[model samples]
Target: MTKITFVQQDGVRIDTEAENGSTVMETAIMNGVPGIVAECGGACTCATCHVYVDNDWTEKVGGPSMMEEDMLDFAFDVKEASRLSCQIKVKDEFDGLVVHVPGRQG
Candidate 1:
């Protein structure tokens, strides 16, 4: 299992263990982390699972695909590091990944 920390815009933090190969959004939702509604259930169709990857972890987390990129445009606070959590698969290398949730999530 890998540990993933989720920091909300309000500074609230949620640290949880994620199984390798699972999406970060799945881990967040399963652990009841606020700010990640995951209304579409990891489908990359909804922007509800939006999160900002910490700068230091960006290269490891990687960028979103064209479809995810297009969906992120509809997020509340889109940033260069913005990513749809559903599209991010957790790996052993992401053991200490840190992500920030936006203030608002639809």
Candidate 2:
């Protein structure tokens, strides 16, 4: 398992464990982490699972797929580091991944 930290807009930090190959959204929802609605349940259809990865880990996490990039356009406070959590598959390399959740989701 790998640990990932999710930081909400209000500075609230949520830490959770995830098994390799699971999506980040799955880990968050399973652990009851706030700020990620995951309305589409990792289907890549809803943009509610938007998150901004820490700058240092951006390259490590890689860029989002074209579909995810398109969905991110509907997310709140989109940034260069923005990503749909559902599109990020957890792995040992992401052990310390830190992502910031924006204030809104819709």
* CA lDDT of every candidate: 0.92, 0.92
User: Candidate 1, clashing residue pairs?
Assistant: none
| Per-residue accuracy of model 1 over 1-106 as CA lDDT, tens digit each | 8999999788888999999999999999899998899989988888999999999999988899999989987898699999999999999999999999998986
* Candidate 2 structure quality by residue, lDDT tens digits, 1-106: 8999999888989989999999999999999988899999999998999999999899999999999999988888899999999999999999999999888997
Clash counts for all predictions: 0, 0
Give candidate 2's total backbone clashes.
0
Decoy 1 TM-score against native: 0.96
Q: Which ten residues in a row have the lowest lDDT in candidate 1?
A: 69-78
Model 1 spans > 4 angstroms off: none
**TM-score of each model, paired residue for residue:** 0.96, 0.96
Question: How far in Å is the alpha carbon of 72 misplaced in model 1?
Answer: 0.7
lDDT of 2: 0.92
